[model samples]
Target: MKKEIGSEFWTVEQTAEKQHLFNAFKRNQRFFLSGRTALDFLIKNIKAKKPIRKAYLPSYCCHSMIQPFLDNDIEVIFYEVLIKENKLMIKVDPNVECDLFYTIQYFGFVDEQLDDFIRKIKQQGKLIVEDATHSLFTAKAFHTEADYVFASLRKWTGLPGGALVWSNETLYAPASKTDSNKAYIEKREAAYRLKRRYIEGEPIEKKAFLTLFDEAEQMLDKDYRGYGCGQEIQEQIEHLDIAKIKKNRQENAAFLCEKLRFCKDIELLYKAVKQDTCPVFVPIIVKKHQRDPLRAFLIQQNIYCPIHWPISPMHKLNVGTEALYKNTLSLVCDQRYEIEDMTSIVNAIIQFFERK
Candidate 1:
């Protein structure tokens, strides 16, 4: 039987032996229903302390990441991010005035240049918010200069509802309660359970769980208020074997990097997985015309790759940023798959390109 590669996480039995993952950054920490909710609360918390008129955000970003600032009535000024030598380079103008600066650790690779940029802007008394959603498992996930840090826990694990937000300073209570998001959480949890059964070769239709996932996502997109995380989800997070998960991801990413390093039709965003990096996905840039075709081919082979994002026209991105958005596709390198699974994906990709 062929195994599916990437999509929503299926439920897994919790290990009896549990471990704490965020002990280092537990101080001033608060949990929320999702990352966007965490971010909404963080923006409000910051605005409560100081008057924030505008925020500087990356041009290449998910709309969800930018929406919180807009919801809080803060103007968002975008900085250009370009791919140079297969690495993401962020361009921020130091002279430009903004109350808050947002930074992202893309695909778990820590950019030292971004750290320096944060330090410089911090000296100017700007509040820094680091989005560690992709880099949550990395050794250098948190930035020293960042006043606030937030990550979406669901991105890394099979959880119903979870996001973590904390500050170097004291944190304020979230405006909304988790009760408002109970329906969304229940739908997602049910979906995870159903997905697990399907994955284990049960005679279940794919649409059974997919429908639940879609409903859950729609609920989130429509109303991502400042809802706190459910107690059950928080408990689930506490019981996770974070170290094992991180190690698995790192090894899988390394194997893929070594195997697909010189593929003719695709270029890897990161050439190698570093000791400190825990990659969420092994991203590749394909030719604009062939990207969709390649993704479709991989799907036919039981590989489900995802585009990082389709750029929003609202951002009015630069030419380079637009091209990057059009061509980028994310390959699965998460904890769910092993080296053998990655080998299968690699062979399928090679087969697709060879046919060209």
Candidate 2:
């Protein structure tokens, strides 16, 4: 094989264990499954009628994540993020009285601020449905007082499916008996397998992944039930020693942060709060003009930094918030990467700036 930049990074937790855990702990008051896990407390359980004024969303989230409420005939309101600010506190529309709110642990850093947001939403008698897809197994994950929480094992753990978790003392209504989407589940499993192999210094073609994605997309068009869906793939979402993952990523991040602090042109998005967060990824928000060039330079050197939440302007509401959308590109920090990997990334970035 030709000399290749070895792709080892974070490894995922086991799948079978996560699925078994899901099956055994179906103790939420009433749960539903779908493309994304949703806790429709009103629908899942018997709750008093609270007219949903609108559904509030953080502008930085994926549309598919917010689709559950939209599909259920609710209006959507967006929460603006102060991306330019130091702490990046989220700004909500106080006037928009909502019956439900979509809270995301953005890159797994939803600490005390999350609680403050939740308290405000709960006062309005609205359900705070948290997307734990990114912030799995953190201190807040297992022991949370949040009304509803759901996580996809694929994001952080080595699992094929997701879990719809809620209060341990709650019950759920069974739906989506037709899980013909097993093929998609299988594809997800296979994709992870191939991706892991390639990440482990094994060769994998980019085309192979694109082909799998196409196949999965076809299945969704044909076999998808409305909401609350899954395959019969049972598994547990497991993680490597999270403490070790956190330590490694932090060490790598700190080294890069030191290197990046002096770069007059590149804007670091958020400060690394290591102990408080199990950061899902690392991102550096750059000036709109600087983003592409910086990404290009890094890619040329095989650094492979990626962009997160690149906007799709399909939603009319996505327009006004464009100013708040800081152009961000990410550097990998999963435990699979060593500090030396980060040093190389910093060197590539330094060379790029020096060339300019």
TM-score of each: 0.96, 0.78
**Per-residue lDDT tens digits of candidate 1, residues 196-231?**
888888988999999999999999989988788777
- Find the 10 residues in a row with the least total lDDT in model 1: 11-20
**What Cα-based lDDT does every candidate model obtain?**
0.85, 0.58
Alpha-carbon runs more than 4 Å astray in model 1: 178-180
Instruction: Please give the distance, in angstroms, between residue 341's alpha carbon in candidate 1 and its true position after superposition.
Output: 0.6
TM-score computed on alpha carbons, candidate 2: 0.78
Candidate 2 lDDT by residue in tens digits, 258-344 = 778777666666565456566666667675467788877776776766565656642433444554444677777666668778778
- For model 2, the superposed segments whose C-alpha errors exceed 4 Å read 1-35, 38-53, 111-114, 142-145, 178-180, 196-204, 217-234, 238-244, 313-320, 324-326
What is residue 83's positional error in candidate 2, in angstroms? Answer: 2.0
